[model samples]
Target: MAPGLPTPKKYFVTAGAAEGSTPLNAFDNALLAARIGNVNLIRVSSILPPGTEFDPNLELPPGSLVPTAYGYIISTTPGEIISAACGVGISRESFGVIMEFSGKCTAQEARAQIENMIREAFARRGMELVDMKIEAVEHEVKRIACALAAVPLWY
Candidate 1:
């Protein structure tokens, strides 16, 4: 690989959902809720650099190629509830890990599942958990519903 830019040092977690008549519209609305509707999302695998800073309210310029690890669920069944969740585990000595889950469930359930996944991931790597962040979203389908959770990594 050509020498890439340095590892990301900043990151943020976000989740959102929306209902629309069509799947695409619902996805767009959900992105709007997550505050990343305008950017070109480049989905990446889950890995956060050590020492990375977390920004609770970070905003990206429009059209930026944002890298993120995310999970999403879309449903068309009326009255069905769908949820998505993402979690990040920071390690004291190495890069952090991220886990995501999506399903027909409550936001709390999704969050709990991803938290367990993050803990297992850290334990598998024998890493010490220093901190963590989790976010989740739930949507009830009237026509179509979409839910998403993500960790957006910034340089």
Candidate 2:
């Protein structure tokens, strides 16, 4: 097989909320709050490689090309609440699934959407879901604010 990134053996879920002067800056600040701002995040589709372990304490270096599944919401309206959530559903011995959702809603609503999506993904694949990890955050916008949730896959 041609060389490529090795299958990830560990992963982590993170959530952050922040406000900034601009939309991009708000998102960036949210990333910083999530502890993943320094690395280059390569957005990937929803899939958790088999046998991957959840490591919430995993520390990644700056400037690394990290594969991630994430969701975020940026709202400029004052007093508006925006929420985002990311979830992973794992089977006993099979490749898992990741789900993400964002909207102008509460964090609990975003989390509920993720949970349903993950369940549907597993059901469609005929896989028995055994476990899940989820992260969610909400932001009340003053000027520009972002709520972000992520599942980062690592070596």
Candidate 3:
């Protein structure tokens, strides 16, 4: 609620994995693969504001300041596995909760962690979870690799 900082009205979930010559590059490429590398991401906490809707076909403007909740892992050890995951738990008639996790693990494991975290968050808030969405990615390191999962909120 400021002049140039408007509240987000829509959101989307995505995941990607990539290998690169360096760690940063791997992360950037992973974001690009996730379709969010062009914009400037302003990392935010794990709360989906009330009334925000989910849009899977969101096309963000390049260089825009996008608010996001994300988790990522970059590994340089060759053959090592890395994973990231994000989950959103929607309440019946109110705000939702977002959770992200990343580490040396499989995508399935990361997904499991995110799911449990979402459940715990809902329980802590005493909110009724009516819907859930999750995304995950896994990467196997060659030189350097990155796995990323994100929930990008936008207008």
Candidate 4:
């Protein structure tokens, strides 16, 4: 790649490792969110082409979702899910994820690489590998809401 040349877009993958949503005020909740926000480097593949449209509600490449081309986005919170996948009318159990091209790789290559990476990540975390029903669609990029609201948790 030459300097000033159009480089492939980079996307970041982030998620809360605690499996599901926790009590809002719980220390684990805050810790997980912080951990998710701190992920600076992640392995991504160039799969889908840039400017691919996504579901109007599930905005991929949103500012809140670590910025990745092909990767996973886990969240127990509704906001994170919507920001990550641009998916609308989805249930909370539907984990947030997006796969865009990373470098100059084709969509297939990017998808394969990302799938493997996600599988490995799951194994390392001792979590079962569940399949995701992903669909490709054209969508416009929109401003993301990065706010993580502090929901009151009463126990």
Candidate 5:
């Protein structure tokens, strides 16, 4: 947490609208700025297009109201990994990623761990966290399937 920083803020993420969307809404624009600008995202309370609020803390369903967007949290790793995977000694400064199925319960289960992995990957490559842009949307088909399979059949 940074000094004099606000916490527990509600961010509204919209699809097909970056920062330049008509009928601009303060909440939506603020959320977009926070994410595009790489501000620490605490939690996304609500989203648009119906059935997108997937709150793990509350153990809610995949469809809450927040529509699937894509691209979640961006770290300093993907860039290095992409470069390394391609057999490059030097990598770019930052990498932009689209977190497929961010709001899907099944896919989101591994999100935290995956985020850590991304961070580690960047650290190994000797890169620092410059900025991150996350796209949140409905969970991907594959990720949802994986989550379903992970659950117990008797449940």
Candidate 6:
């Protein structure tokens, strides 16, 4: 955690896809498409803190260690549609929950699945949903392809 930084009061969601000659390059391209390619991603579990706000245009500096909850899929099978999605459910009590999914499916399906997961998570915790955020991406593989969705927490 960065010293003197606010307690991650804002966050953002992003999704993207890309194709390349290799799996690693495809994944990097996906990250570039998602506009977080240069940062060091510190992947965390799905949980949005109390009082957290959403920012659709949030940008972190290159090489920053960003904490995120994310899902991704890579496909080498030609013509395969790989998709990823993430959903967030904000509770009236000030916290939020996140769910992520990735598989060989349409982006819409992946998004729907994550949304359902978020709803179930909130229900299990007896939390009332006050807001929601969803993001999804899909890629059809010619050689190597990757798709990813993420919720990046900011301080």
Candidates sorted on TM-score, descending: 2, 3, 1, 6, 4, 5
Which one wins on TM-score?
2
As a TM-score, model 6 comes out at: 0.93
List TM-score per model, in order.
0.94, 0.97, 0.96, 0.28, 0.23, 0.93
Q: Give per-residue CA lDDT, model 5, range 49-76, as digits (tens).
A: 1222222223213323322222332112
Clash count of each predicted structure: 0, 0, 0, 18, 20, 0
- Give me the candidate number with maximum lDDT: 3
Root-mean-square deviation of every model: 1.4, 0.8, 1.4, 17.7, 16.8, 2.3
Cα lDDT tens digits, model 6, 1-155, are: 65773457779999999997899899899999998888989888978989888888888999998888988998999999899998889987667998889999999899889888988898898888877889999888898999999989987
Per-residue alpha-carbon lDDT of candidate 2 for residues 107-137, written as tens digits (9 for 90 to 100): 9999999999999998999999999889999
User: Regarding TM-score, does 2 or 4 come out ahead?
Assistant: 2
Candidates 1 and 3 compared by lDDT, better number: 3
lDDT of 3 by residue, 38-134 (tens): 9999999979989999999999999999999999988889999899999899997889999999999999999999989999999998888898899
Regions of candidate 5 where Cα sits further than 4 Å from its true position: 1-110, 138-155
- Misplaced by over 4 Å in model 4 are 1-101, 133-155
Per-residue error (Å), model 4, residue 148: 23
Compared with the true structure, all predictions reach lDDT values of: 0.89, 0.93, 0.93, 0.29, 0.26, 0.88
Least well predicted 10-residue stretch by lDDT in candidate 6? 1-10
The lDDT of model 6 is 0.88
